[model samples]
Target: MLETSARLLRLLSLLQTRPEWSGPELAERLDVSVRTVRRDVDKLRGLDYPVEVDLGPTGGYRLGAGAALPPLLLDDEEAVAVAVTLQTAAGSGGVGVAGLGEAAVRALVKLERILPSRLRRRVAAVPVSTVMPLRAMPTVDPTALVAVGAACRDRRVLDLDYTAHDGTVTRRRVEPHHLVSWGRRWYLLAHDLGRDDWRTLRLDRLRPRVGPDGLATGPRFVAREVPGGDPAAYVASKVADVRAAFRCRVRVAAPPDVVRERLWTDQARVDDLGDGTSRLHLAADHVDGAVIMLVGLGLEFVVESPDELGEALRALATRCRKAANGTSGGRVGAPAELG
Candidate 1:
């Protein structure tokens, strides 16, 4: 009886490892007859495991979704990975999902209670830390994320009320394409039906329009190719546009491709001037911040905007000179001006 029970567990683990398995393949793996494989599959079915059978020369058995979630089988690596992910998510205040932290803690507790001592030691050895930001991050409504995700998957249209950064609320009908989790914020890449354009919208500022029957999704539409053939890149460009408060155009002494490789997408937009040089457009919240980024590029650059950026650069040069000379005699500058 104990042998049979252990074989049943091995069979379950094997089935969970792959999407489908033939009877002959299972028999070979278990060193049992095909008849015994069929009998064990029947026993799994009797236990409400939803083991589905396909009848034919090329058919195979596969596990299907049951009415309720069954216990999952995980290898050592997978178990450790899941525990670490859960721990990080719990510590991150839910990764933009409202109320997910407490739920993650609960789930982690349950998982830890069932874990073996060896696995517990492995999980404990992992060094995971979450640093809370000075400002609280905007969180998305879990219901909105679910609705938007479903619409994206099913190629359905969604009617939503979106709040713009300027505190303007607008009703938008869009075909949801993808949900992007960039940093702590969630963004939706969708084609706006009303405006006849593609848009990257913040999930936290979005509320799905619901009816008496729950979320009122529009009829499924043919999936359209995302702009630039990449959803993430498109969303990143849009985010850069929104975050650009202090914009500076600089002429760099480097090729466009080289500048692009050196900087992140959100840092600047580089345009080739057909010469050996490249034009870089940089944006940041303050001029000093932009100066710092420009200096870090390690290439010669000429700032061509706002005039304040030039002043900040000169001030930075002065500070660098003062530090190099080790002289405090020159009317100590006003709080470094980098703020």
Candidate 2:
């Protein structure tokens, strides 16, 4: 009886491995007779596993979804990967997934308790994950992120409740193409059905409305090729196109590649001047942020436009001078000092 029960468990695991398995294949894998395999299939069905069978040359048994989460089969490597990913997610505080970080932590506790000593060692060996560039990006809703990702995977259309950066929320329908991860943020590259244009929707600001967020029944779409054939490149091109009030270009006394390495690696476009110098063209939403980035480059540079940026730089310089001369109440890098 115990042997039969164990074999049944093994059979369940095998069925869950993939969508379909023929009777002969199952018999061969289990080292049992075809009749026995059929009986076992009946037994699994009796247990309410929803094992569906088609008796034909090309037909086979399939495991359908059940109300409860089915038992998962994982080898040592897969187990370790899940553990490490969960740790990273928890560390990232679920990337603003509400209870996501808490869920990850809870899952980690359960997973670690059941993991074998070898797998536990492997999970412990994985180094901490670090978010790149600026980590100050807003948190993303995990449910919404998964929804858009599923839409991309299934080639479905998504209706979104997207909050624009200007603090206006709008209803939008889009054919999601890809979820591009730029630095610590995720952007969905999609064809806006309403606007009849392509847009990079930030996952953080993406949300749902009433019900039925993704509609598979709607018109199926094959994503058109974006420029440069890359979503990140396309998104960057779009961001660069929206140059605002403060437009400043700087001539840095460094190679284009060197300057690019130092600052605005993504925001600024670098032009090689061919004389150990490069010109950086950048646009910003904030003048102070731009000034801080320019001076933070620690390279000699001349501002080329707006004249407004020059005043911002001068004001920063004055503040620094006062801080250095000990004439001001505050010191240099006071923010860093607060930390």
Candidate 3:
């Protein structure tokens, strides 16, 4: 009886490994009678496993889908990959996905406990999983995020009030399509009703509310493809809109590589001026931030466009001039404290 039970388990494992297997093929592999194979398959079906069967001369049996989660049979490599991925996901904050990560780890531990000694060592050799280091950005309510995500997957439309960078409040109706996560920020790619165009919006900025519940039933919207499928374009566009307020530019006297690496490595567009100098064009709505960036780099640069950058530099130079001359009126030092 015990031997028969073990053979039944091996047969079950084999059936799960493939989509279809003929009665004779399974019987030949298991060295059992074809009648016994049929009996075992019926036993699996009784256990709530959907073992599908075909009749006639080309008769075969296979495993089919069931309502609830079925037991999964994973080979060595497959098992190891699941364990590693779950460990990584635990730290990745996305709505409540962190909880899924935790569950994955617990499940992996259970699987490892039953794994053979060889398999256990292989899974253990994988370094103890650690969360990746990443800057924290804004986080959204998990339930709300999941609800909206479900809508997107179903191709639904949404009505939301989003706070603009200028603090101006506006309500918009949008056809939500895709949710993209870059670095620490989340973006929603949707079509705006009022604007009649596709827009990429910050998920954090959206004041999402329960709406009139509708799908994007008009037409199947195609997602816009950014150049080079660049992941940075969406964030770059957001930054550009904010920077447009301060129309300024600067030329830094340094090699292209050096200037690019130092000042404005992420933001500035560098044009090689040749002869060890590069033109660094910076555009910012707020001069203070731009000024701080340039001065902080401690690089020799010339303000080239908008002239506002030059004006800012002059203002800083004047402050130094006043501080050096204690008379406070372009006169020689006269501070009693300094003397």
Candidate 4:
């Protein structure tokens, strides 16, 4: 009876190892006859495991989803991976996924209780003190990310109502390939069926329905290899191509490579002059963020155009001068001019 229980555990582990396994394959792996394999499968079913079977040539058994959750059988590497990911997510403090840190911490505590000592030590060793820069980048809905991710994994076509920057709602039928997170945003790299091309979509702007489009959902598509064979790179390339309302051109006393490291490469176009200096061209929704970023660079730069920017800079300088000399007050300051 003890041996049968052990064998049952071994059988469960084998089933969890893959999506499907043939009866002959399971028998060979378990070193038992096919009849015993069937009986063991039945016993597993009795234990509330959704073990599905198929008959005929090339038939197999599949571990389907049950009504209730079962104890996860994770190997050493899988266990370590989960624990580390949870720790990192909990430590990040809702940076990528909105409001997930608290839930992740709770999940982490529960996970640590069931984890082996070695894995517990590994999770404990993960530093929780890392900090992220305060950027105004939009956070994505964790539920939205998970939903889109599931669709991508199942090769299901997604029907979405998306809001564009202009606030227009458009219906999209997309075969989602992968989810790429960068620049504090989640992007879905998918093939747009209506547009007949590949498109990168921001996850926060989508309202998705699980059902497929009438004809588009006819069959599941195999994930196509994206250009450059990197989904993240593809998303970056697409995001870099976006244009804002206000454009700014400036010349900095630094090399293109140095400037590239300090800014978003895709959003800013950096050109190397034959000299040591480089030119930067970028766009912003308003002059506010641009002014702050350029001043924060700590490098000598000249605004090439836009007299309005020079005026704004001169006003900023006047304010700084006043604050430095204790001259700031309720009254208006002098009209400072910029060359």
Compare candidates 3 and 4 on lDDT and give the better one. Answer: 4
CA error at residue 50 for candidate 1, angstroms: 12
Give lDDT for model 2.
Answer: 0.77
- Identify the candidate with maximal TM-score: 4
State the C-alpha lDDT per candidate: 0.83, 0.77, 0.66, 0.78
263-300: candidate 1 lDDT, tens digit per residue? 63254677789888998888877787687778878899
TM-scores for candidates 1 onward, in order: 0.65, 0.67, 0.44, 0.72
Tens-place lDDT per residue, model 3, 1-339, is 998888878888888777679998999999999999999988888888888898857558977657775677777788778766655555453322324555665776787677889877776687754554323346655545654575576455676778886878899887777676544456777778799876777777876666343222333345545434654555444443443556566777788778655653234566787788877666654776678778877788777776666777787777667778753664455542210
Q: Which ranking of candidates, highest lDDT first? A: 1, 4, 2, 3
lDDT of 1: 0.83
- By how many angstroms RMSD does model 3 differ from the true structure? 10.5
Measured with C-alpha atoms, the lDDT of residue 23 in candidate 2 is 88
Model 2: colliding residue pairs:
none
Candidate 4 per-residue lDDT over residues 1-339, each given as its tens digit? 998898888889998877679988999999999899999999999999989886857569978667777667788888878878877778887656788888888987888888889777876776667467556566777767777887786677888889887889999988999988665678899999999899999898987765432122334677787989999767866776676876789999999778767773245567789699998876666676677777867788999967767777887898789779988863565553332
Query: Which portions of model 4 show Cα errors greater than 4 Å?
Result: 1-39, 52-62, 130-139, 211-218, 249-283, 291-339
Comparing 1 and 2 by lDDT, which wins? 1
Candidate 4 backbone overlaps, count = 0
Instruction: Report the candidate with higher lDDT, 1 versus 3.
Output: 1
